[model samples]
Target: MTFFTFVTRGLTRRPVRTGLTIVGIAIGIAAVVGLVGISRGFETSWQTGMKSRGTDIVVSNMGRGLTPKPFSATVVERITPLPHVAETCALLVDLISVEKADMMIVSARQWGGFSWKNLKIVSGRLPNDAAERAVVLGKTAAEVLGKKVGDTLQLETEELAVVGIVDGGAVVEDGSVILSLPLLQEITGNQGKINIVDLRVTPRTTKEELTRLCAQITGLVPEARAVIAGDHIRDSQAYRMISAMSWGTSLLAVLVGVLGVMNTMLMTVFERTQEICVLLAIGWKRSRIVRMVLWESALLGFLGGVGGVLIGVVGVQLLVTTPAIRGLLEPELNPQFLVMAVAIAVVVGVVSGVYPAWRSSRLTPSHALHG
Candidate 1:
């Protein structure tokens, strides 16, 4: 019989136990796929949105690396006259945690400006009254909050009316509420203060010119730093933390899978002690026995990898389609990441088999057969 057939026969001896071991490995891989996939999707979506918007540069207070200090909205006046600056808009951003629900970071944006043009309203209209407490929801924010046009949400002490829903396609905006800059300023008690200043530059502005302008903008306000829109994501500590957590959590799941495989292979070695001894007595080399045990473990891991991929796909689909997480999370199934999951499983299998395989190979035929 072929080597693979031999390994297959051994695995089939206890089909139920083998199946359970495969499932144990599968669960770990699925966790890695889902968590890491979602985080990567979030990063890609945010970066794409940042670049797609015609806005060329972003200006924000360069305070603590993660926490940007708010600057006076009047800084827009200083930035507008800078060379290559076509338009400027001030933004106020903050996180509002709904009682018993996920926290949403909402943006208070300048209405009737070039920066606002990118937002396409799906249903309803932009807020007409900047003075009134009016808010617009991104497709995801609406679903998460379960609010629609004309519905009122009590934000802090004030009740704000939802005037519109937008499809911005950016995860950050899609999962957020938007309000008129003035209203947000009033609500946050930081009137005439802002968090970000986005700038659009004239067409044909060279990269060198853009760099010079960024330096000039920084000089204009010693507290503020200007950077390319895409680079802003790199500067964000929260984004880095999320990325770290995704892989970090995945590592734990992989470790659990390793342990499961190790336990299962060890048990298999003990149960097959007599069979292994007979093979040894018949002149099967110790190295050959080691290879057989490893091959069996590898097969189990491969099967588990396939099952894990399926589970991850189905689970992510269900999550993204559900109203609560739909707009907020767009799970990405990157081919490389899926491949890595399978590779991890194979490695875990091989590593887990080593000790058990070695112990079985060392058992003398006399002792193994008599025991």
Candidate 2:
């Protein structure tokens, strides 16, 4: 029989143990893929949402929390008149229990700002003006809260009319509760307060010019920082937290898989001693015997990796559809992640098999045969 076939048959000989080992590794890999994918997706979705709305720079008081702390809405006026700044808008972003949603994103944008233009009304109409005591619902938010045009919804203690259902184009935007800045402020008791400012630069602004402009903005507003939109999430405290947690959990899962693979390989080495001795007696070199053991473990890892990718993809897909996470962010699945996972699995297999391979290679044919 061929070398590859021989390696595979040895794995197949004890199907139950091999299957369990593969499954253990697969579960670990799936956790890594799913958690990492969602965290990345969350960051990407916010970045894309801002980009779609033509925001070139984000001005906020980003701190240790996931949400930037509220600041005076007047910051937008100071920023708009600055050089290279063509347009600007301020937003009050908050998380609150809204109707059926225990927690939801509430985005209240400055009246008549470009930020409002991101939503395309599929039905109904936007609030007449900043003080209209009305609201527009994102299409997904409408579905979740079971609201439609002309329905009245409660905001804190104030009741507001829902005048429109909008398609926000991005997942995070569509899942949000959007309203005028003035009304939300009145209801939430955050009068004249805002958390974020979006800015768009004039045409043909060079990269160096943009950097200077950011410095200028921060210089103008001592309490706030201006970050280019592209690097927004990379610098956010919240994104860093999300990434750290995702990777930390994934590391634990991978460690479990490493131990499992090592155990399976060591057991196989013990059980296959006599078979290895027979091969050595028949002129199979010690190196060849070691190669066979290593190949067997590597095969197990490869199979586990394939299974893991599928499970991870499916798990994330299902998870994002659940109400708790729905419309929050699109799961970011990259081709590179799949390739990396498979490669890591193969490496894990080879590493796990090293001691087993060494032990097999050290066994003299006569000693193993007699033992």
Candidate 3:
């Protein structure tokens, strides 16, 4: 029989064992691919969202550690007319419970001049002006609250009329409620006070130059400090913890799968001992014998990888559509991730086959014929 025919027949010899081994490896590969994809997607989404804000510099009050401190309204007013500053707006964030459901509250000024590229009004319309008590609800948040445009939402201190439904196409924004600065201040009991400032610098301003300018601003205003929002410094610690947990869990799954493949390859080598001996007896060189065994293992690995990638794609689809898991982390299945998964599977197959292939090649023809 030709080499291809022999390999095909060998796999067919024990269909159940081969199938189970393939599945084991596939589960591991799928875990790795899915986790990596989700993590990358979250990081990308965060960066993109920050970029959409179009704020070159962020100024906030210095609080404990990296947590944000509330800045006074006076501080916000002082920096509005700083050199090279085209426009500035104050943003206030709070954790509020609405109808017993916890939600994030975001309040920003009208025409205080910052812009969001992705914040689009899908229904109704934006508030008439910043001073208006109207609010915009993110699509997901609206669904969760069982609310729609024209509904009145009662908060701690005031009632807000839902003027529009926001569809930012981003997971983070989809879970927030945006309102006018004046209205937010009234609800939070912080009237005439600002918490954060988003500043847009001139075209000539570089990030480094902006940093220096921020330092100068901080010196000028002792009550407030400047920060770079895109740096992710605010959530770095939290993200690191989350990333480490994800990677650890994924690695463990992949390791279990690799062990399954290795065990299967080893057993296959033992089962084919006499056949290998016959090949040696017929003048098949040790090198060729080893190559053939290795090839079989590699093929199994490749198949497992392909199956795993397919499964991962399905998992991603489910994740995106599932409401409970949506926005927590979204998995992006890209060509690069698929290619890498397949390549890694092939490599794992070769490595797993090495010991089994070596053992088979070492068998003597006389011993095999006698058996």
* Winner by lDDT: 2
Residues 1-371 of candidate 2 have per-residue lDDT tens digits of 78999889988988999999999889888888899889999888888878877899999987876678888888887888889998998998886788777767789999999999988998999999998988888888888788999999888888889999998888878888899998888888899899889999999999999999999999998778998987776777878998999989987887787788889888888888888888888889999988998998898888888888899999999998777777678888899987787777778888888889999898778855585
The candidate 3 region of ten consecutive residues with least summed lDDT is 61-70
Residue 219, model 2, lDDT:
96
- Model 3: per-residue lDDT, tens digit, 38-136? 776666655554566676777776354222556677776778777777777677755456663544435455344455435788899878887787788
Model 2 gets an lDDT of: 0.86
Compared with the true structure, the alpha-carbon lDDT of candidate 1 equals: 0.80
* Cα lDDT tens digits for candidate 1, 163-260: 99998767767877888898878877988899888889999999999999999998988768898877765566676787788889887887888788
TM-scores of all candidate predictions against the true structure: 0.84, 0.95, 0.79
In terms of lDDT, the poorest run of 10 residues in model 2 is: 362-371
Q: How high is the CA lDDT of each candidate model?
A: 0.80, 0.86, 0.73
After best superposition, candidate 1 residue 194: deviation in angstroms?
Answer: 1.6
Collision count for each candidate, in order:
0, 0, 0
* Error in Å for residue 29 of model 1: 1.6
- Measured over all alpha carbons after superposition, the RMSD of each candidate to the real structure, in angstroms, is 3.3, 1.6, 4.2
- Model 3: residues >4 Å from true position, as ranges? 1-6, 57-85, 93-111, 116-118, 128-133, 154-159, 181-197, 206-235, 327-329
